[model samples]
Target: MITTSRIRVWDPLVRIFHWSLVAGVAANLFLTEEGGTTHQWIGYGIAGFIGMRIVWGFIGPWSVRWKSFWPTPSRLKQALRPNYTAASSDNITHTTLGAVMMLTLLALLIGLAVTGYMMEETTRFWGVDWVEEIHEVMANALLLLVPLHVIGAIVESIKKHDNLIGSMVHGYRRVQIPPQHMTKHVDDRA
Candidate 1:
């Protein structure tokens, strides 16, 4: 392994949002009764987190901002290249594909929150089949993608010899930066 240095990547708020999202998803999927009060409250909490994340994407430090990892079509292509690495001087945060996954997860969370609220709080859609179907589909989709997200994180962490999981918990990763790629870090973790 190349020599690595500690640098902050995820911020504290980002870390909190991440683990909270995981817990909410897990609780609703495995612990709570469907449409139960606890489930609904967790869903509301998740929606609030997503809303804050979206706002933070605008105002957070450069590494956590949307512009830092906005996976445009062309950008996706670049990210897919065999040699693509997050250690790039220009983009040192989430892998581009990870950004895609993050956006998909957030979108699904929003769908669940809205549909769940409609079913629980509104009379017009209380018995609607389509809304409930949409909600279930999104939740199941999360079941599939959440595992993939975890697997990807594990794979990258091992391949890069960096603790991707721990980075989220504590907001730092030990990364090897080639001399040619050295640049001022964008994150303001301190």
Candidate 2:
């Protein structure tokens, strides 16, 4: 058995935002026809989710805050250290690379949303080639990045010996620490 702490890192809002965003992206990317009302509504919903997440980062729990996992140069260095562990991070919702990817994904989503709105709602950008091009590029970029994000989650799960996907789903994570680091006795025989 592993001595671990069951931490409520993801929280309900975070998990809901995560999975709902995933579904909305999938629906917009595949299920719904582009330029159709359904697709446009989905895009608007995704934009809303992103907006809520950004606000949550400011007022939500410490674990989900920007400062917690912003991947600053110093924090990245610490995460990149050879002896780093999940315990090394004050926030487990993202690794250093995960933080970078999160920011990239958010920017891309915002780009998609803005370009989408421009194409749909504004005369200046409506029917404009460049605006449509940017929207397509952003959607394609999201398609590319989403898979890599999944792979990263799998890799992190293996590396940490924890179920990161489960954490996202259940809003809880079992953060295992080495026996020596524990203040109590453990039976980590395996």
Candidate 3:
């Protein structure tokens, strides 16, 4: 049996934003070829989700803040060190590569949504060649990036000997060292 500390690391809004964005991406990718009202709605949904994520990065929990995810050169080096492979269980948040993945996904999503909207506007002409080209480019690029993201998650999970997928679902993970060990370490600094 595994026990996890009840630290509310991921706010409910962040989880909702994550899964909703996943669904929106899937829907937009598979359904857009048919070109219907549903596709347009999904595009709008993706845009809304991305917009909320930008806002949440500013106002969300400290763990999910932009500063937390934005890797400085030094932090990136630290993250690349072998120590990350044996990360103490309490530090299960996104790593440097994970941060880059998030930013890439955000940019791709926004690009997809913008091009999709512009491609549909009559005044802008639904048949604008550049808009269609960029949409196709961004879509294919994102599809390639998705596999990389999955591989990174799998790699991190394997290195840390933890069920990363399960953690995302349950919003908790058990550490080998007790939470008290971490809390004590923090207290020593204060």
| Ranked candidates (lDDT, high to low) | 1, 2, 3
Relative to the true structure, candidate 3 reaches a TM of 0.80
lDDT of 2 by residue, 2-66 (tens): 45766667778999999998999999998998988999899899999999999999999877989
Error of 1 at 46 (Å): 0.5
What C-alpha lDDT, on a 0 to 100 scale, does residue 119 get in candidate 1? Answer: 93
Q: How well is each residue in 1-190 modelled by candidate 3, as lDDT tens digits?
A: 3334433346677778888887888887885653577887888888998888888889887766888668779767877787664355245467777887878888988988888788775666588888889888988998999889888878877876666666666555444545444542122211
Candidates 2 and 3: which is better by TM-score?
2
After superposition, candidate 2 runs with Cα above 4 Å error: 1-3, 80-90, 177-190
Highest TM-score: which candidate?
Answer: 1
Decreasing TM-score order of the candidates: 1, 2, 3
Of the candidates numbered 1 and 2, which has the greater lDDT value? Answer: 1
Per-model CA lDDT versus the true structure: 0.86, 0.84, 0.72
lDDT of model 2 at residue 57? 98
Model 1 C-alpha lDDT per residue in residues 108-144, reported as the tens digit of each score:
9999999999999999999899999999999999999
Query: Which residue pairs show backbone clashes in model 3?
Result: none
Which ranges of candidate 1 are over 4 A from the true structure?
A: 1-3, 82-90, 178-190
Error of 3 at 128 (Å): 1.5
